[model samples]
Target: MHASSRRQTNCCRKPSTSGAKAPDLGNYAMSLTAALNTALMGLSTIQAQTGVTSGNIANAQNPNYTRKMVQLTTPAVGGDPMAAVVAAIVRAAAPNLLQDYYGATADYSRLSATTDQARQLAEALGIDDTGGGQTPLQSRLTSFEDAVKRLEATPEDTTLKALVVQRGQELAKEVNRLASQRTTLQSQTQDDIRTGLDTLGDATKAIAGLNAKIIGQKAAGMPTGDLEDLRDAEVAKIAGLVGVRTITAENGAMSIYTDAGVQLVGTTAQSFSYDSTTGTIRNTNGDNVTAGFSEGSLRASLDYLDGSAGALTSSDGNVGAMEKFFNQLNSMARNIADVVNAAYGSNLFNYTAGDAAATLAIDGAFTADPNTLDATRMGAVQQAMRNTTLTATQINPAGEPNGLSTANVNIFGLVSGVMAYHARQVSDNEAARDSAENLQANVEQKFRNLTGVNVDDELAQLTVLQNNYAALAQVMNAIREMFDEVISIGR
Candidate 1:
């Protein structure tokens, strides 16, 4: 055969080792690259997960920090089957639990404010001092009664007359001091209302600003977990100041309103103005509207200062309980002065016409000369002290008798009744505060269980991430060695 014919025959002849497989270097390189990419992706996911777990562990003690979880999702990349990406970082917060916590906090704050004011009133009234065994007012009243009885037994004792006058002055002083304390409380409440308004304004504005930021971030496909958490915290704070309701829109915008349906924040924050002089809550448009606050520190202060719930006298259509208490004290002072002046034919006590409690004093004639306190009219004095038929018109111009029209009551009895009523109010408020605190604790615990970080759980998650990272690294090392082997073979 010719040389060309022999070469053709050799090319067409079958190989001796038919079982041996030939390596496809192009396909092997592609497969190795794809595998390396997939392993790198897995390592990246583990890194992200480890960062998240580390963050959780670091913020375990932070009350404001919510636990973060990274969600994994497989991408549509054609190269690798196991490659994944981070889809989102989720904050472990339950909206229902958050709302419940806000409500409980508001109730607790309201009760706390009310109880604090009541305790202050009790202290001022000298009724809460157990160390003295008896209140100063009670002691003075008892001493005056004793002196009057002794004067009745021995009408000739000028020294007993002086003692009776001294005791009467002491009783008047106590009443004046209590009334003054009430006035101070009213002033303090006014300051608190102003402070609350300022706080509300600041918080609402902050919420509105945050709403804008959140909306922007959501539109830009940015993570808003931290901003949302901050906004929620601010909302909770506002709820504690004034019971509020929140509405979240689809665009991540949030609106806030009072429980009474008064808008506080929306696209723009609404401004509030408080008129301490009129005890009115008004909007920026200058319209006076009822606050109608149910549970909050502001609501509690307003209730104690001017609310209609616990008034002693509902006359004249006025509702502030503290104001009514003060008015009742003034009326009692006026009644005592008028009756004593009528019985002794001398002005034993002097007081202003409208504000008798604030200005009650022992007359100079009675204080300087004990004889001016005549014991001859003991019967008339006793009758005046026990007078129950004293007309409301004589005591207060706007006051009308409460309960029975012809009922009989002494000065001490009427005053004690009002004091006891307020004391009961204080006790009830304290009980309510305690109940709310317990409920708050339970709700807080429930919330923490659902959203709080557990060290053991986090550690377990970290271990899993570590193992994944190690496995992915090994796969990467294998891919690198395979690439080197393929290069050596090519050389």
Candidate 2:
């Protein structure tokens, strides 16, 4: 036989010595092949781990990105267990922490929305006139009172009467300006509600689509880490717009609902509509659920626009604080006009009944001729300003009784009371917003620590994977060399 064939035959031959058995070349070959296959699989696993680590490092700065990990598992092959293999990739997230974050986000958004609206209204009414320590309304009303006092002191001064009429005109002008601004704010709030509803609807649809995709991927045994991250982000956004509850199914599908148990997303998304005119929210079934949202910016805006605090008692119910303030100003203007007309037997101020604040003006008789100002009624008007308790009923912009029975105050007392009330509301809202925001920041940091990628940890994992890759490659190269040597011997 040729030299190479002789060697091959001896390799397969049994030992000639008595009681000795031949070597199992077939089994040895099978073992070598198995070892090679195992080594290859280890190399592939290390490579996949390296890729996962690299992705983590790449997305370290992405706030929405969650850290990913590969699960290693072993399987038996040919009666022996193989090395660990990459079984699945999973996103690292603490469900409890994430849920807490969602709640905090909703709270922060609600307080922020309320605070912004309150601040805007306060500014419009000049309630926050820190520069002068007095709002325009307060200053104008004070000037009118001073003019009245002057006329009281000199009951026959024609110039003083003209001055009183002029002050009344100025005060009426100021009240009208404030009312106009409030109307503008209401319109703007309506627009914002419409826009927010649109955004919420879009978010819900996207979540539903993602739910379908995730369910399909899970069924197909595909990786769903990225999809889950995207879904979580969408969920947070929706929570900020409206209070929500979530449920996860075994199929990896997520269901979303409002605090009021209104389903927002499931296998299919539910559509939403907002009626800015009536300040109503409805679902695809057209059912009114205005009170469904208990937390979120949408709820805050609705509360401010509708003037309903949802109180139980009639004295504090339905009427929003902003609308109540408007009504109080209207009542004060009406009371001033009524007392002056009754005492003087002449109309001194012209105003509509319900909208005195907006329609209040000096009567044409008084404006055309200062001599028409009745000084005889000056004492009664002054008494009304100082001691008369005027009662103003609260009503919403829709002219519905808000259940806030009555707000009682003297003439200038109502003006000061409204101003003070606005300042207090603004202050309280700011404090609440700040507290919620701080809590949200702390919660977000904790959440990031739990689920966010750590650069140092990822780097260490990458180093380990690199070493594993090198070791596996070396084993593969050694296997190749051994196979080549065996082939040479056979030759």
The TM-scores, one per candidate, come to 0.87, 0.86
Residue-level lDDT tens digits of model 2 in 246-266: 999999999998877878887
- For model 1 the TM-score comes to 0.87
**In candidate 2, where is summed lDDT lowest over 10 consecutive residues?**
394-403
Output candidate 1 Cα RMSD: 4.2
Model 1 residue 64 CA deviation (Å) reads 1.8
lDDT of 1 by residue, 1-491 (tens): 69999999999998798788877888989989988877887888888889889999998998777888898898766553477888887789788888889889898988888788777766776667747356676676667667777888888999888988888899788778776775577888889888888888888889899999989988887767778878887887888888888889999999888788888897799778778766788877787654656568987777666643334344321235566557656766776777767776778789774432456788888788878777987667766677645543544444432222212456666556555655765788789899999999999889999998998999999998898888888888989999999988877
Model 1 spans with C-alpha error above 4 angstroms = 1-21, 307-319, 338-347, 355-358, 379-409
